[model samples]
Structure formats: structure tokens, C-alpha cells
Target: MKRIILASAFLSCASLSITSTAAPMDFDFSGTFTNDNDVVLLDFSVASDSTVTIFSSSWLSPDEGNGFDPILAIWDSSGNLIEEQDDGEVVGSTESNGVTYNHGTWDSYFTQFLVAGSYQASITQYDNFAVSTSLADGFERNGNPNFTFDENFGGATQALFNGVWDDSDPRTGAWEFHILNVDTASGPGPAPAPVPAPATLALFGLGLAGLGWRNRSKKA
Candidate 1:
């Protein structure tokens, strides 16, 4: 009788652990921005310590100039910028009318290790670089073609975009993004496991002792 109870207790503990585990998460997103000045922010959470990858390389090969150049940025739950990426592995090019347009593809990517917590991912177009370390600091480029640049690098739109100094091309603001290795709960950390009560813990010990005695008896 005692042996059966111990075996049942062991099975119960194992079952509890298995049932409490969270489902894995991987996501792909596609959307368009309202206009050149638009930005897309995604909010997600990981249940435990894990790695996250953001990618936007779709606008490279077949259709180069169809979409805007993508810039990806990750922000911690505390609204601090972790890192940002302007372009990916491949450069972009397209030919329209008669002129051959040469520029980076609509690609941006990054893989980062993050603690269990909530985070934000922001996507902007070319010349719209994230300006500060804080998420609230905003991007460098607004809709205006002629404007003062960032204070750190201030001038008449002080950026040499697509081989043109202090200039940028008109973009449709189309975009896509992917996120991998996240918890299904979309939380900052792993699903919280329920703590066993004192009585349950005592049972665990008793059950282990009983199981061990039965094993010894069988061996003998």
C-alpha cells in the first residue's frame, strides 16, 4: 500500500511539472506603415532567459525598391534601447525608368540574449535612425526632407543616405518583421511554477524514502 502511494506521489510531481511548462513561441509579422514618418512598435515578453532574433530581409532579391529600407531596434522593458540595426547582410539595388538606383535592401536583423522580461521592437525606414539610448528619445528623421539632423550630428539632414549626403529617397513605408525563441505567454520570463505546500514537500520526502526501501527490498 505504501509503495503504491509513493509511486503515485512521484507521478503526480512529474505530471505537475510537465503540465506547467509553457509553449514555445515564434512569430512572423507583415504590415505597412501609414507614411514616411511612421514607426512600428511591437511588445512581447519571454518567460525565462532566452535569445530573440528580429529579421526583415524580405525586400532584397526580386523587388528591391518596392519597400522602404528597414531599421530594427530592441528596447528593454524599462524603455531603454538595447541595440539597433540599419541593414542586413546584403546591399540593395533597383532600376527605375532609366536610372539605376543603388542602396541597401529593405533588410534589418539582430539576435540578442535577453533576460526574462518584456521588451519592445521598433521598425523604421532609412534615415530614420533611432537617435538616443532611450526608447522615448525617438528617431532622427521625421517626414521633412530638409531639417536639422540629430544634435550629435546636426546639419541639414546630416546623413549620407544611398550615396547622397544629407538626402534620402522617398519610401512607401512597407515592411515585415520576424521574432523567434519566445514564450507563448508573451511574458518577460518563463511561466511561474506553483510552489508546493509544506505538506506536499513532506510527502515528497516520505515518498522518496519509501520508494528507496522498496527498491532495496526487491534487490535483496
Candidate 2:
């Protein structure tokens, strides 16, 4: 009886240690647009209920001649547009989420809670001088003439195309971007698999040994 109780206690400790060591999901990437309508695509997967945050600080103000004004768009695997953001600092902008980015001349940040799934994201230049989706129009520049995709933009695989716009114009600089996933506890989805610590593994082994001893004692 005491051996059985000891086994249960060790199991409890192992479980606690494993859960406490799990890490959040995050990714950071940097790329550049060589022309006015350059676009870059990134793919990521979420294993549980998570808040996906995408942001960039590589934009330049209008005063900077070669500065880039970035636009970000996210889509599901089926090509449906989920969300898009142009300016993170715009007051009362729903896409901004009231978060300010101070990395460069301009700020761009976006956040959304998503269920477990695969998603695609696009980052492109937002040229005020170009004919593109207006802020009031929700930045719907996916099919617009100013912005075009490569032949494999939304194909079966993830791709990054250089200067793929139909027009000759392209954004003339490089850009840096980041995507992060923050797991939440309120959803009915499965949690991410925990990474067991060495101590947790030791406790787990102790539990198995205790159970083996208990079984032998009962047999005797």
C-alpha cells in the first residue's frame, strides 16, 4: 500500500514538472523587397488555441525617399483572406490592436486569436504614391493591379517570389518581419506536447520502479 502511494506521488510530480517546462511558439524572419510591389510569403502552423502576432519595424517614413511602408496580410490554407494590417500606429485602427511598434521610421503590428490550423502570411510594400487599397477599404490589395502574385503564390507549397508583380515597379529595399504564437488555456483544443525536464524523467522512472516494487510485494 505504501509503495502504491509512493508511485502515485512520483507520477504527480513528474506531470507537474513536464507541464511547467513547455515553451511558447515563435518565429523570426527577415527579407527584402527589391521593387515597388515586392511580396514575401511565410507559412506557419498552430497546434493549439493561440494568439498569432505579426509585426514589422522595417518601414520608413515618407521623408525617407527609399523607406518602405509595409503591408501585411494573412490567409488560410484555402486562400480566404483572414486579416490584413497596414499601419500599426493608426489610432482606432482595428488591425493595430493599440500596440505601437518603434523599430524604424514607421510601425506595423497585428494580432489575432486563431484555432489550430495552417496559415499563410504575406508582407509587401505599401506605397502611398501607388494605386492600391486604401485604409478605409481594409487594404484589400491582393488582386489589385498594383500588386500581383507569382504563378505559384497560393499553390500547394509555400513559396517566396522576387519581383513577381505584373507591373515593372517594385519596392526598392529590404524588410524584416516576425511572427509569434502565444498559447491559451481556455480552448477545447489539445495542448502542445510538453517537453519533459531531466528531473521529470527521473521522477517518471522512479514511479515505474515503485509500481514494479508494489506489484512484487503484492505477489509475495
Candidate 3:
């Protein structure tokens, strides 16, 4: 009974040691914005085995030359720069008979690399005077291209995106943003627990035999 209890305790502790450290962390952001062509930046902590995804959505712009271009940068948990995409025009633009449209509902994923805890996302309108009219209609020069930009960093930290525009000026429009945090649950990978070797078992058996023999001699 005593040996059974000891073995059970050892197994329980080993299992607990493995299971206790198997928790998944997550973050998510989503939303829409109106005429404020500006930069949106986000920062998140990155673990050695962490994965991250960013989702972006926006209503189609009315202006013909206006399109949404987003740039992202990532830093490791230790404040080291890990990855960065610095293209004034990261998203490809589509045009139909001289009408241009940018990609919306964009998503980017990061994994299998070391990244810093901080991330920055910046957005800029391709054309200065473009405006969003509808989803299907490409950006057309309305009156003035006061594009809107908003952001949700999607982690423990929350940031508010605010840009200044002149309401009195017909060229400027209101910039509104909404950020949503999503679920972050990671499935365990194929890493299996290491089993004890035959050599270790043999050593344990020898130790047990020695202990038993010593106990018998003491009893005699």
C-alpha cells in the first residue's frame, strides 16, 4: 500500500508538472472606421511559442484614388525588434476602368519566430483627397478626402485612436473606431513527455534490491 501510494504521488506530481504549464494566451481586435487617413499602431507580448493574428475591416471608400494601406511592426517580449512591414502600399489595389479599391477584411498571422511584446500598426490613405462612399463603389474624389482611421491593439493594453479634422472645412470628416478583443486558445502541439530510460529503471531496481537486502540483514 505504501509503495502504491508513493508511486501514485510521483505520477501525480509528474502529470501535474506537465499539465500545470499548458495554458494558452490570446488577443483579438475588430471594427470599422470613417474618414481619418492616419496611422494605427498596436503592441502585444510575444512568447517563444506564441501565435498572433490581426483582423481589419473597413467600409469601401467613395473616392477614386483612395485606398486602405496598413503597415505592421512587431517587437519581442524583451523589447527587441522582430518583424516589420514598412510599405506605404502594403495592400494591392484593384481598379476597374480607372476606379481604384483597397482590400478590406484583411488578416495577418505571425508564428514560429521570436517577437517583441510591442506591435505597431500604421495606416495611410493612398490618395490624399479620397473618401469612402460605399463598399462596392471605388474611391472617388468627392469634395475633400478626410479619411478616417481607428485601431484596437487587442491585448491587456487598450489604445484610443483619435485624429484631428476640421469640421468647418468641407475637406475634413469624422474619424470613428471600435476595437474588439477575440478569443485566444491554442491547441497543444505534438510535444510528448519523455519517458524514463531502461538504464534509469535498472538503476532504480538495483537501489531497491540494495535497500531490501539491508533491511533483511537489520531484521536478522
Candidate 4:
């Protein structure tokens, strides 16, 4: 009886330790340009209490045009700046590939781990330019010209847009921007979110082991 109790207690402690010592999971965000509109600002929500590590982005550009500048900004629940990427800071740029790039492609990417929860992404085009998109990929947005995120089909991953406009003047032409939530391709879904304190898992394991030993002794 004592041995059985001790063994059970040890197993419980082991489980606790295993749970507590677990490492923070890595995160990823990969998106294809679903539209050709230059995004000025994008917004969405992340499951609060998670770390967003990878944020890859890129946009298509008309030959020789500029200013998609691709700024990535993050705000807290109260709309405070938590992190900002390319906010007036240019990471890198490549010339247009004759694709007009109005609905830009994200061959360009940014990476960062974030504390999960309500967050936002905003991409923008400051000057006259064009990008590319995959609007032809089944979804439709007519008359409005601007495609807004469908909250029903959106959750952890999504594409958010600011708006789109066509310019009469080529130089002062219209610009577009987008913000999006990172999503995965297939399978069960997002892995368990990362916790701030990974060491807690070891502590849990130790505690469980102690408890099991005590219980076993009592039974004896």
C-alpha cells in the first residue's frame, strides 16, 4: 500500500514538474497578399497572454513608385504603443517586378515575439503608388473598393485594411495600407501559448514529488 501510494505521489509530482518546466512555444505569422490595395493601417486582436515572435511582411510596388513603407505598429488594450516596426523606419526595399504591386506581396518579412492579447497591425503607402492582392481568391468587395476584415471568418489570424483610393494624378496617386493577424496553413491549430515564467514548470514538478513522498509515508 505504501509503495503504491508513493509511486502515485511521485507520478503526480512528475506531471506537475513537466507542466511547469515547459518552454515558451515559438510563434509564426506568414501571409500572402490577399489584395492589391496599399494598406495605411491594419488592426486586429491576438489571444491576450501570448508571445508573437514572427511577423513577416512585404508589398508589391508599381515600377519606380514608393512609400508602402510598410510600418508595423502594435498597441495595447488601451491603445498604447507596445512595439513599432518601420514606423518611419525603412527596413529594406526592392524595385517593382512589373506586377504594379498595388495589392503588394510580403516577400519582405519582419519578426518579433509579442505578449498576446488585443493587438493591431497597420501597413501603409505614403506617396503615389500601387500594390497587388488576391481579391480574385473567391472573396468579393465591390462598390466599397475597400475590403474590411470579416470578423466572423477572423480570429487569431486575419487581414485588416485601412482603405483604398484611385488617384487622378499619378505622382500624388492613391495609397493603401493593411494590418493582419498571422495564421498557419493546416492541422489542429495554434500551439499552446507561451507563458512568461517557464521555470515555474520545474517548481511544479518538485512540489508534486514532495507531495507524493509525503502521501506514501502517511500510507505506510
Candidate 5:
């Protein structure tokens, strides 16, 4: 009986350890665009229902014609549009001779809490000359051009930019982004007690009973 109790205690400890050591659900990605009509696509999957927040940024500078405007869009697995953003906010700047050069116009930013499931995100350029309402529509209105520019860097799946260009071609650029999932219940309120397995509960009860019986024996 003593050996059986010891083994049960060991098993319970192992189970607790496994339950406590869960991997974090976060990811980071970066990519560069080579062609005027280049688009970067990222695919991600969520195991269970969760609130996922996504953020995106573009490389910007004060150098003439060095800044690239970026646009971000997300879609469900079925190709339905979820959300899109043209400019998030100014992320960087440079100061020279008491002058502050704001580069916010070129940088892009976006965030959204998504439900658990498979989803895809697309990053493309925000054409200064585009006339269409949305980037995706602009590409369709114009002739679908082949995205063939090679930016010398690779990570995301590339596709033709699906939007109208004010001019005849799309702009090229680079982007950095990340995703984070939040556990709202664990953030503020008291953490709920973990439910013990039936077998573990039974073993724990037996151990208590054993101690009670031993105490009675000593008293007698």
C-alpha cells in the first residue's frame, strides 16, 4: 500500500508539470517586396478559440524616395476579407538642424483581435497614385501584372499586388510584423483552481485516509 501511494504521488506530480508548461502562442515575420506588383502572404493556424492581435510596420527613412508606403490586409481561409489598413501611424523619424522629419506617412500599422482558426495576411505597397477605393480592387481594374521583382530576401509567399496603381506599376518595399494571443481571464482576476483528475483525486483521498488511520492507531 505504501508503494502504491508513492507511485500515485509521482504520477500526479508529472501530470501537474505537463499541464503547467504550455508553450506560448506568438510569432514574428518579416519580408521584402521586389516587384512593383509584389504581395506577401502569410498563413497561420490557431488550435483553439483565442483573441489574436496582429501588428505590422514598414521600413521608413527621411532619405528622398527611400520611404515605401505599406498596406496590410487579412482574410479568412475561405478568402473572405477580415480587415485592412492603409496607414497605421508614424513609427519613426529623423531630426536634422533643429528640424524634425516625420516619416509616419510612409510607415504602416494595424492591429486586430481574431477568433481561433486558419487565416492569411497580405502585405503590399500603398501607391501614392492609385485611384481605386481599395488596393485589391485597383489591381483588378488594371491589367494583372506579373510580380517578378526579386528583393534578394524571401519568407512569405509572393503574389501579384491586387490593386490599382495610380501609375502603371506597383511600389516595392519591406515589412515587419508579429502576432500575440492574450489570455484575458488570467490577466486580472484570480486564477481559477485547476481541476484534478479523478484518479488523482482518488489517490489523494486514499493518502489522507491512511494518515488518519495511522494517527488513530498511535492514539490507541
Candidate 6:
């Protein structure tokens, strides 16, 4: 997987900042992955009990142009991995963006209803996952050695994945993480998202561990 690395004024590791916005607003963090298994970590919070949606769609259509095969995840303030979604059946067809990233099933999507609190989110490539339950430890593929992938698709030995899957080459590009339906208070109020701190950005401890699932956005 060759990812074209681009330079931007934006620091790779962003600081967590918050903003208020109007209805149907989106909060996102952008970065890049230099190698396989590279992951981006972001900090965010929900003001109250409500439903939140997050997805990575740039890799799908030419719209954003760079978001790659994103894997979305979240953890509690304690750093415990809560949930990680691989494929989400989001856009059924192309909308105003005239983009249908939902077709690849490559984009990550998921929604959860929860109480307001601080949380950490992560964005990763195809199969790269969090090595431990804690966010501080980083991802399994973050520091992976230069090797080759094998039949052990999503096993503990995944650190051995050299980027390429069975036939699909590994890739690099813009790394983006987004949160939808954010609020400024305990209810639905719009807010601006903050960038993460230079922490080089760095979550799946497990859950979406395999290559297959039912009713996902699409299939490889």
C-alpha cells in the first residue's frame, strides 16, 4: 500500500479544541499515515445523552479525495476501548456530493447513543487494530516491521501484516476522523470540533476483529 504523503500547515498531531455549530454539523480531524498500520487518535466529547454518528468517506468518492480505508472507534475517558466499527451501510446511493463511498464498504461508519462525557476516537487503515485495551499503547500496526501478510487475516499475529492483504496492496493517504450530531449541552446543540494535541497521532483492542460481517456498508 503506497499512500501519497502530502504536506500541510496542519500539525500531524492536533490539539483537542471544541466549537459550537448549527444543526446537522460535523466535527473532524485530518492527518496522514506514513506507513501501513498507521493510526490517528482524536479526543472528543458528547454534551448529553444522544445519538452520535461517525464515518470516513473521502476514500470513497473524489469529494474529500484522500480519506482511505478508515476504521472508526471510540474509548471512554478511562482509555478502555468501547466500540470499533469497520463497515457501515451508510449512504445507500449517491447524494448531493454525487459520491457513493458507501459502495466500497471500505469507509467506516457507526452510531451510538450515550450519555455526555469525554471520549477518545481512532482512525486506522484496513486491518490495523489497537494492540491493547489502553489508548496509550497505540495500534498493532503502528510500528509493524517490514514483512508480508499471510492467511491469519485478523489474528493476534496481525502485527506481522506488512500492509498488503491477500491481494489488495496496502495504502497511505489522508487520515480523517469525523463525529456527527454533536451538541453543546446535555441535548442537541451544534458545536465546532477541536484538533488533537501533538500526542504523531495514534484504537481497536478487538470487536471488529474479522474480515466479514453481516449488513456492512460493502464487501471487499
lDDT winner: 6
Q: Of models 1 and 4, which has the larger TM-score?
A: 1
- Which lDDT tens digits does candidate 2 get at residues 39-118? 45544456666787777655532222323556666655454556666666533212122233234423357677877665
TM-score of each: 0.55, 0.46, 0.29, 0.29, 0.45, 0.58
Lowest summed lDDT over 10 consecutive residues: which window, candidate 3?
206-215
Give one clash count per candidate, in the order shown: 11, 6, 30, 52, 10, 18
| Tens-digit lDDT track of model 1 for 1-220 | 0000111111112322221144434444445554444566655557678887666643452342346556778777676777777665446433322323333433665578988776666666555666677655666665443222232221223232221123443334345555666542111211112112221122122110000001111000
Q: Where does candidate 5 stray beyond 4 Å?
A: 1-24, 61-67, 90-105, 128-172, 182-220
What is candidate 1's CA lDDT for residue 176?
Answer: 50
Q: Which parts of model 1 are misplaced by more than 4 Å?
A: 1-21, 61-65, 90-106, 143-171, 184-220
Over 84-160, each residue of candidate 5 has an lDDT whose tens digit, in order, gives 65655546543322333344543544456666555555544543122233323323212323422232112213343
Every model: Cα RMSD to truth: 22.4, 22.0, 27.2, 22.6, 24.3, 9.8
TM-score of 2: 0.46
* TM-score result, candidate 1: 0.55
Task: Report how far off residue 33 is in candidate 4 (Å).
Answer: 16
Model 6, 27-117: lDDT tens per residue? 5445555555544555555656668776765555454544456667776667677777676646543321222233345666777775766
Tell me the lDDT of candidate 3: 0.23
User: What C-alpha lDDT, on a 0 to 100 scale, does residue 203 get in candidate 3?
Assistant: 11
lDDT of 4: 0.26
In candidate 5, what residue range of length 10 has the lowest lDDT sum?
A: 206-215
Backbone-clash count (model 6): 18
lDDT digits (tens) for residues 118-180 of candidate 4: 333333222111111211121113222222333211120224332222211112112222222
- In model 2, which residue pairs have backbone atoms overlapping below 3 Å? 32-174, 35-170, 35-171, 36-170, 36-171, 37-170
Better of 3 and 5 by lDDT: 5
Question: Candidate 2's error at 174, in angstroms?
Answer: 1.5
What root-mean-square deviation over C-alphas does model 1 reach? 22.4
**lDDT against the true structure, each candidate:** 0.45, 0.39, 0.23, 0.26, 0.37, 0.47
